[model samples]
Target: MRQPGRQTRRPERRIPQSAAELARVHERALAEAAARSAARDSAAPDDPPFLQPRPEIGDSWERLRRLGLDPDAGAAAVHLGPAEIEHRRRASGLDPLLPILRGTLVEQGEQPPLILAIADADGHILWQEGERGLRRSADRIGFFTGARWVEERVGTNGIAAALRAQRPMQVHSAEHYLRSHHSWTCVAAPVHDPGTGRLIGAINLSGPAHSVRPYLLQLTATAAKLAETELRARRLESLHHLRTLAAPMLARVNGPALVVDAAGWTAAAAGLPPPARLRLPAEGWGSTAVHWLPSLGECAIEPLADGWLVRPVRPQDAVPAVPGGSDGPGADTAGPGAGLLAEQAEGARLRLDLHRAGSPELSVRGAAGSWSHALSPRHAELLLLLATERNGLSAAQLADALFGDPARTVTVRAELSRLRRYLGGLLAHRPYRFAESVLVTVAGPEDPYDLLPTSSAPAVRRLRAGLVGGTVRLPGTPPLPGPRPRPGRLPLPPP
Candidate 1:
């Protein structure tokens, strides 16, 4: 409360009028923050109510310190060879967008020159171009093609920070963890695959610290967005091409049929409502052959230039004849569909070989013969959850069980779709589970704790910790009467 005769004075915020002044202010604040961090026992200490490093920069500094990185390290070494760099450039999805990035950030020829660098998801610089003097400066710091700029290698920098945060970021002067980079300023943004939402690479605009401006962040971000837009347009164009080619082929099919691209985007459909996409098997359409599909029973697949044509077999064409003569005891008494129904009831046999630590395989034996596929760590975790819960699990439930976050339903669905492509009709949806007729059997390691050794999913972790209540016994092994003991800590039979 102010006295009637006097007025209270509030501190006024002072805004820097030029980039140099701003840099000076940032340097002072960073010095104080760095001093505090150095004197503290913890990598991350509470910031006082004063000018300090931004949250992202502070977090990165903390991470670098925790990783035991030397702040005075020299220029980062280029670890990627020329051949490997070329391969990455072609596969990065950024190579084609170089022209757009150059036009937006490089070709501008602004007063204070800057360099443009593109790094793949792994933080290896694939391309860099800019004003001649600026390029030389960048080269002096090993900011050339094939140089790895990830935090683990070069300490905190724009490309590494943007990729780590999965967003646009700017690192200026002392904000960089390495003292060698203190004279440089960089602004970067991560680019993602529009179709799959996977980070492909990052675009960065960098120059001497004095050239840094607030607008550089937006400039880099705009360049990254343009690259994503181009990628999305190209995807749409490919889908259109597939659609045009599929029209006549789908028209000639008599029964339910559809055509889909390699990524499972539907191009055309006949005799059925077109699904936005179908989950194709992991092996994909290796050759034109008959394959069992979860959504369409049995389908004959024909390979196209860029996609596949799938036609479901009609019921009359799919049914097999009874083995015995019609005069046999039950043959004559049964209807024409009895044998098919019996076969359907018997279903398929599924065997999960998870006893080994690193090699997990799923084997299925049915009317189509036997085949097996190696399971990725994530797939193995999902299968384990489904096998344990015989009644099945909803998308949300599975998401919660796997990630400890029920809101990650989309991630759960995507993974399950890939799993279904290979499993075919053996797996079922609408609360994902093995088909009722599938004879599901699991073979875990002799030690329950050794199950899915590489899995970190919440469900797997809980099961390994003996937090899940159940009698999990391997085939021919006696069931433990009570809760299972954690592996490595106690002697226990495999579940």
Candidate 2:
């Protein structure tokens, strides 16, 4: 109440922080970050490269809080405005999973660290996944579901701590500077997409300090993997729809060039008819340098100075050879030429698609038409970069481009096993196996490294075309049929 002409002033909000609180926060940050760095180094040592920190983590957060920063309020004070909360929610991709994950925290199963709050990748709590009261209080203190939690913004918690460590972690009581969170222990692990291996989110278990042990970090890590795997399955199913429409335009392809060496044969030119070269029916015309497309049978094999090209021999001015279909100009069914064209187009498109698919997540194709791929997004990216380069990338080159830490080469190699499995599963097919490929290393073709998607499409096509087209020799005895109807008009007038 204003007394006459005097106005009342609102009390300023003071952060509750003891000296111990400050030290605990700083120590946890340095120690955890160092541990993660060491783990990364030990996991990758052959590469002698190094990296540096940005906007240094030291004192990044406490300094901001001390400055009374609240961008939404447009005032230098603590305020969790609606706009700010929404902003954080969107940035984190958290709104989709918040309710379900939060429900799990509250449900009567094995109670984990009560997730009082949860933030997205950017450290913003898109939704609180814990006790309502704790959630409300935390929200008031600016720890709602949708709010940033970068190390510099907020020090030491399941969210920031996990991101800082780049590993699963538990930041126990006293480790958090804000008095509001001192009663909690938060365990967090990053969640990634199995397909791309990108960090999508983090699942955190927050509860009373006594309930969560540091070793529980292992459990969170496993759970995070499961979550990621499930997401991968869903993503694959969705992407499959995009990849495999009902049209028979494409089929699962995998492997390297199927080679048939013609070292024993003589050479010829493309247009020039070599008197020594004999024309083989639809297929027999082929060379080691280049083979006839299996689909076009009995084609003339003409070898050019650069390579060999096979042209099909369709009978000149011949009628459509397709059975049980109209042979008119507007025939809608797949005629001989059309069938051959479809195959040609498919072959062309397959090469382009495989080449453009960017990342060869899986190198091997299996019989089942699926293949395995990398579990680490970083590795997948490295594989793509290596495949794209004129020369295959070395371990050091990959590490430097990916993490700016040349030491990550070992992790990259270790991760390839998982990538191989992923790739193998995705590209499963018979005759198109995805083992390590023997490609010409751009640096030195003889010094082959195995990160590329080596495909033997030509060889596979040869076998497939023969199997699909050659085996249609119907063996049953032929029976005479009833009188055929008149062309275009019925025989009613004659009857």
Candidate 3:
């Protein structure tokens, strides 16, 4: 807890002081006032104070002079009153707005088409996914940052309509209500959590009507897909994080979890009540929460919002013992020859499982808590052989220990080379060397790694629950039927 005035370690960044100029451009107060004055009404409608032109602009030079601004320095800034200063503090950019607007649409050397930028309701970039030059343009337009695309504020542009309609739409060229935007076309699509019907956001592809392609509509969908894909992947990562952290806790409490990702898929899961998977239908699991099965052992799950949770199962639920090392049939019968190789086989199993899902990672550590980044089964064997023997294994001795056949001489040497390079890379500070034809182990009193990286403390629990022994139930579409099952073979359509 922070004391009332104490600073937190997560320091806040300083707000930029250039916001005054940006406010003047985006709000267009001067232009509106000019139009109002021209309309024969001396009194203008109330305008946001910050939106009024800065007195420091070209015409305001003399006024700036009174404020002690040095014209020669190019460092003189807009002088604002207290209220104006506070309002500017809340404005978006530190850059001059006109230059930003021009930079967004116009080209400069090495600065391409993505000059312009635009943002959505949640202050996120939506149309910025277009060509780089246009993106640059939008950026200068104040469309990229602190933009709110919610319906009432911006009307039916791609971002606003998607949220309001809760469906995808394309607000192409000439469709814009704001006459100022008659030059550009936009295509946008809404992303949904199919299970919950919650609209995450929309992706929009926009560019100059003359330069952009009609098929940017397809590009819009593609961008939405990419976003959804990323959401799903992040879910999986969160699940893995939960799995590792929840291990110690899950042992203490019994509970099942359903891990959801931003894209509606249940990315990773563990301790799901058996009855839920077996008794309930397959389609039953996607979006909503169901009643808990106390028989599975009641456990409370804490949700780590970016889609991860770890909780205990019901206390009454029975959890079978986890296998010590062996799994799969044919567990015995390795004979005296393979008796020492069991851990190597177990390590191999783990490696294969990892590769099938994603990356391959295997670790073997001594009781002293030292880790060896063992890749091949042979590597595990050599490490184990080194640890067990009272007498060190020489080049010839290791060859005998690894493969009894002396003809396998060069083969053992190759495996040793691999192991040496791997461990050396991982523990670079404390070097491991391969000298002569022999393998040597270096003992250095160094502490192993203690913490794993994660976003924050709250997310740690859910991330750990994801990785270990969890099943992910992904959304699926029914397969197309084969030509209506050959009309005659299936009964003819009933009238």
Judging by lDDT against the true structure, name the best candidate.
1
* TM-scores vs. true structure, each candidate: 0.55, 0.38, 0.32
Which lDDT tens digits does candidate 3 get at residues 384-464? Answer: 344323244555555654445445657656555434332322211111222222223322111100001101111111212
lDDT of 2 by residue, 1-495 (tens): 111101112211233234355445544434445364443345356853332221112222333343443312312223356897777666644455544554444464655435545555556555565566656655554665446665445554577655433456556565554445566666777654433333456777766665654445565666655565555456546543432331132122121111111211113222222211111221233353332222222344444332233344532322222233322211112212212222222212111012221122222212211112221223334343433342345555555555556677775564443333223222112212222232211111111111121111122222222222332111111322544333222122100
Roughly what TM-score does model 2 have, to 2 decimal places? Answer: 0.38
Give the range where candidate 2 is weakest over 10 consecutive residues by summed lDDT.
Answer: 1-10
Q: Identify the superior model by TM-score, candidate 2 or candidate 3.
A: 2
What is each predicted model's overall lDDT from 0 to 1?
A: 0.66, 0.38, 0.34
Which candidate has the top score in TM-score?
1
| Candidates arranged by TM-score, highest first | 1, 2, 3
Badly placed stretches (over 4 Å) of model 3 are 1-144, 191-198, 252-495
Relative to the unseen true structure, what is the C-alpha lDDT of residue 279 in candidate 3, on a scale of 0 to 100? 13
Best to worst by lDDT, what's the order? 1, 2, 3
| Candidate with more favorable, higher TM-score: 1 or 3 | 1
